[model samples]
Target: MTWLVTGGAGYIGAHVVRALLDEGLEPVVIDDLSSGHRGFVPEGVPFVTASILDGGAVEAAIRDHSVTGVIHLAGFKYAGVSVQRPLHTYQQNVTGMATLLAAMADTGVEQIVFSSSAAVFGAVDVDLVTEDVAKNPTSPYGESKLIGEWLLRDQAVATGLRHTSLRYFNVVGSGSSEVYDTSPHNLFPLVFDALLEGRAPRINGTDYPTPDGTCVRDYIHVADLAAAHVAAARRLEAGQPLEPAYNLGSGDGVSVRQIMDAVARVTGIGFEPELSERRPGDPPRIVASGELAARDLDWAMRHSLDDMVRSAWDARRASTP
Candidate 1:
């Protein structure tokens, strides 16, 4: 039984691919190389350079690989960019999910692990968001992901297609020495790049209600997130009934100032962040409660904030040509 990982050449997807391999499972990767890098796909894995929006290609890949399960990770992820390109975000995230589901139905692949985001919750009032919180997405990116999760739920009820949607917060840390760096829209990479370039990293807001005044987010290590994916896959393989959406996060909100402090502590880079006015749609606090994932998948985060920063800094330094 082979597993298909859409966007497997991207940052978190690549780490999930590595975890799949470590578990002795064959992972077939499908990435369009738009935001993903071909080099990130591990050697020996059957990789198909294609977009998930292409239903024909997706169906063919699933059929060709005899794919039994899927890890849907391909989608537009930039929250700010999604606001600017709402149509494009809808096309890539919403349409892409529809196309994949159609292809899965055609190929008789019933199980899926969706890469959802904490964006679905948008600006929640709760400090620790659980799975039952009302979904009030603020951006098109978040809406698209919520739509994907809805589609999965609908499909599961209508067609017996069991699926697990893992709602994640800020996914950080590099899983391998060859860093699969993300775009500048993400906070960690953007800060890392600025620090590396001898410039002060920009802190968008420092007057929020959080203790540090900056936005607070649950930043989970990519490796630990990948481990949760493996556990989800194993649960399905064991014929367990599909559970509700699971939150994969640290259950603690790390402030932007705290992150910068960790970076400086880890890498000895004493560059201070330049505080700026709050960007539009910037949430004050969006921490997650991973109680569901922990109870169901038996997942636990092992990396601390310092550990995450150090691993990311190491990867960033090593990637500099």
Candidate 2:
């Protein structure tokens, strides 16, 4: 059986593809190269360059590749930027998801592993977020992912589409040196870019009430995340019962200050991060309890903070000219 990995050429998507291959599953890729790189698509993996908004194209990829499932990861993912480009974000995530689901329905593709986000929870009054928390997404990107989950759930009710959404935040590190995090908005790349150019990396705020006086959040390794995705797919394929959604998170999260320290230690660059005023809506902490995920999806923090920084730095440096 083959799996159609939408956005398979992306950073996380490419790692998912590699995991599927390592697990002996045939993987096919469909990416429009919006934020993904064509070089990330491995040789011998059948590739189709197209948007998920194009139902005909999605359907063609599903049918032609004889895909038994889909790992949907293609969408507008920048939370901060989505506020300024709500229309584009909604179109890519909401409307595009609808288009993909339509194509799946048409082609009788039943199983899917949706790449949801922790952003769906937005600001929280509690410390340890769980699946039961009220979903009040603050950004357009988060709202779109929640809507995507709804699409999957609704379709499942209507047509027996086996699905699970993995909600996570701060997906860092590289599973392989070939696939690095390239997002300009991500913390890792921003710090990495600064270090590469012999500049200081700055923290937005450093006076929060955490142990390190900085915001703490889950920072799961990409390989670990990809492993959960594959496990979910296998369970779905085997008709094993699974939850509707699971948080692929670190039970205990790391702080931004801790992360900066790790970057300095890992990259061999020592500099104190300059602190700026806190960005509005930025919470002091946004950690999740992955106890449920650990029980069901074989989820664990296989990489330490230093490991994440080192691996990501290696990949990013290798990719640099």
RMSD for each of the candidates: 1.2, 0.8
Regions of candidate 2 where Cα sits further than 4 Å from its true position: none
Residue 260 of model 2 has an lDDT of 94
Which digits, one per residue and each the tens of the lDDT, describe model 1 over residues 1-321?
A: 689999999998999999999999889999999998888888899999999999999999998988999998999899888889999999999999999999999888999999999889888888789888999999999999999999998998889988899998888888898855677778888988888778998889899988889988888999999989888988887889657689886777789999989888888878878989998877798888888888988878888898888888888888888
Model 1, poorest ten-residue lDDT window? 178-187
lDDT of 2 by residue, 1-321 (tens): 799999999999999999999999999999999899999878999999999998899999988989999999999899999999999999999999999989988988899999999999999989899999999999999999999999999999999899999999999998898899989999999998888888888899888989988899899899999999999999999999999999887878999999998888887788988889898989999999888889888989999999998899999989999
Which parts of model 1 are misplaced by more than 4 Å? none
Show pairs that collide, candidate 2: none
Best by TM-score: 2
